[model samples]
Target: MLRYVIDVVEMLDTPKTSGASLAEFLRSQGAENAEIMVKTIEGEEGLSTDFVRVFIPGSRGKSSGGSAPTLGIIGRLGGAGARPERIGFVSDGDGCAAALSAAAKLLNMSAQGDVLPGDVIITTHVTGWAPTEPHDPVPFMGSPVDMETMNDFEVEAEMDAIVSIDTTKGNRTINHRGIAISPTVKSGYILRPSEDLVSVTETVTGVNAVVFPLATQDITPYGNDLHHVNSILQPAVATDAPVVGVAITTAVPVAGCATGASHATDIELASRFAIETAKYFGAGQISFYDADQFAHLVSLYGEATHLQTLGRTK
Candidate 1:
């Protein structure tokens, strides 16, 4: 059995959804004995609010009762304009789907806390991969390479929520760019240098938006990439945290490959790696963002700042 901790932050005004509701949602889905707590302060500088704490049990198989894990939730309310700009929740499970389910439910409930119509909901998941074996080089032939499934997990968010995710997994080599000509194309040929480009790209074609981390360093230092980047983004992506994207400029690379050394000759030494970077950088918490909503936030804040400056001058 795995343990999970969930933290919920309320960013909007009005009686938004509470952590208790989210816990209840999970319970309805066959989750057992979710613990809940609420923190409220009156006449606070911000709006009056409540913080709910909840704990949820991990998914294994249903059993009668054996000290099931508890879910915790905390809610806080402040002044009208004091609503939290973002809310977050974290859950752990045996596989990805279980973790994702908890996160998706929390975000969906939070987004609809006030139960307002037309409220936008978005969701996405980021996957991290650690190479368990050395990289194997294969000739660029039109042949299908068998991939051993290291780990497979899924997180289900609201059906309508838009998802933007970044996956941290081992890299694959493909023969598409260019090839050199020689008397014996297979034996005497020059191989072009492979570029290590890591950036957020589209995944899942057209389901909201998905970001693929494809830069070399993003997967470099083996353990570093996985530990730092994925660790930070995991909760946010899994729980549908509100933000644009994580700023990973100052993150350092770590040592260790997912796959071992000397396993495959074709695989590059620095080709695939995963590592843990840091706990927190900015705001002390990693931020997750929906592609469209984040853009709207930027525009709204930009205009608000301009108006405030103009009013001061007038």
Candidate 2:
């Protein structure tokens, strides 16, 4: 995984990185059965980015007529680089790097006959020249496309559970220089953190697991004129399946658009954590949230799906 992490970060650090190039790299890695799709979309500002999706079939995966749940590993970020404003790959790109590195490792493993039980889909965008925007405390990277566009390509209906990786160093909270996990977010409900996932994190990092604070607004859809920690949990707004955020953190606040802020070892740890979760989850060994508890909450209260929308206009 360390090797894969290093390779991926190096590949993304360049301003010439694109979806087709990444897709070509992944195709050459292995996973002959994997379905890889690359789409290039031009933004309103005339800037275009590529979206890459890799689906690795498992031994008992649905693609092969098995009932095992499919696990999605999504790399959520505004862009990898903020060109004209900042050079090189930005810190926000770490999430994409980790996710793609995990995909590469899985592909290699599958080629060597180490397939998991269920299917795994990894998706992310390649934006080498993204825009920058103003945020509280620090500046942030703006995507070439809108959040809905990102969700349309990355969030798949086949995913039973999703692990969203993002750089959350722009905030003052969770002042640690490692990886942190956000509580489970499901259909507008911020459920408690999954113990199985925490165990995975602790085991991977060889330290106590770090859980970050999840505000209500964080789970809502973007463009609602609300402050979100970032788009780490944005997938939850597009699906009913449980979603968890794997955040790359820092000991102090750092801008997402800042260059030379990514830590290779930290990225590896996050990638390992995502891989572990995908393994156990696909094998039906872990649960993101208590199903019965979620049912109870919904039965006691009501549907929280409205939060997934822009809300009643006016």
Candidate 3:
């Protein structure tokens, strides 16, 4: 596993901009496969501002092969000029999220042969909050843990191609503002009109059967009037639908609840719901994605394979 930390000096720089520079620098350092971390210097200026660190596993080889490599990229921003209370630099959350996702794709490609052109990569953000309780030994000394729950801030994924989720004139409430971004990005390759996000289904031919049942967590309520109200199970029933391959997008945890709850707790609940649902539905494989982490899946019954036959004709 490789862990790298980098500092970005430019005040108004975006993740994409900084990522490109870091990626190029890695290439120059004879790093065939590297995980980099970017961070800005806390109280440094110009020359000492932008910095990057790279982590490589095992002995350094001329070729970028032979072992599984992991990489991390971190960046920090600085505050205004010489102000005591001025906000210093911090890492771009969105950029970090996207970079992590890209790294995941690279890892997948390296581990498993070539990924299909239209394979879907899902990314999600979950956040939760709860009141902090006092550290007291006595039973009534500490404050009561009033509310604790998580929320799905966003769910994004990219497929080989995008399909429209129409919400033209119907109830605008169904509009999946968060879920729709991934499909739109993918739609460029496949000519499809954008629509309101609803659901997605894929049929794998090689697989014997597939099923997805609601998990216990999904049925349970988290906070007051807050819960996962809807769920869409792909391939509702196990069908011999030419099981060529299977891919299930992972759910993500959101960040920051309205009332400052525990983000970890919310993510745990969502993940539990996903795990139970996947198991109940007989999913041969499962994957995970988060803001800090990217797209990654664990195959329960088979190898991590790609669907090469999609959009192909005999």
**Candidate 3 RMSD to the correct structure:** 18.7
Which of candidates 1 and 2 reaches a greater lDDT? 2
- The best candidate by TM-score is 2
Number of the predicted model whose lDDT against the real structure is largest: 2
**Candidates 2 and 3, the one with greater lDDT:** 2
Query: What are the lDDT scores of the predictions, listed in order?
Result: 0.21, 0.93, 0.22
- TM value for model 1: 0.21
lDDT of 1 by residue, 208-252 (tens): 222223222222222332322222122222322221121111112
Positional deviation of residue 239's Cα in model 2 after best superposition, in angstroms: 0.3
C-alpha lDDT of candidate 1 relative to the true structure: 0.21
TM-score, model 3 to reference? 0.21
Would you estimate the TM-scores of all the predictions? 0.21, 0.99, 0.21
Candidate 3 residue-wise lDDT, 1-314, digit = tens = 11221221231123223433644544444434444554433221221123333333323221234222111121111111111211322211222222232333333343444322112222221101112211121111100121110011111111111111110111122222122212111110111112211112211112222222223222222222322212111111111111111111113322111112112222222222222222222222222112121112122233212211122233
Task: Give me the runs in candidate 3 sitting further than 4 Å from their true place.
Answer: 1-37, 41-102, 115-178, 182-314
Predicted candidate 2 versus true structure: per-residue lDDT over 1-314, tens digit per residue = 99988888888988898888888888888789998999998888899889999999999999999999999999999999999788899999999999999999999989999999999999999988999999998999999999999999999999999999999999998889999999999988999999999999999999999999999989999999999999999999999999999999998999999999999999999899989988999999999999999999999998899989988789
Better candidate by lDDT, 1 or 3: 3
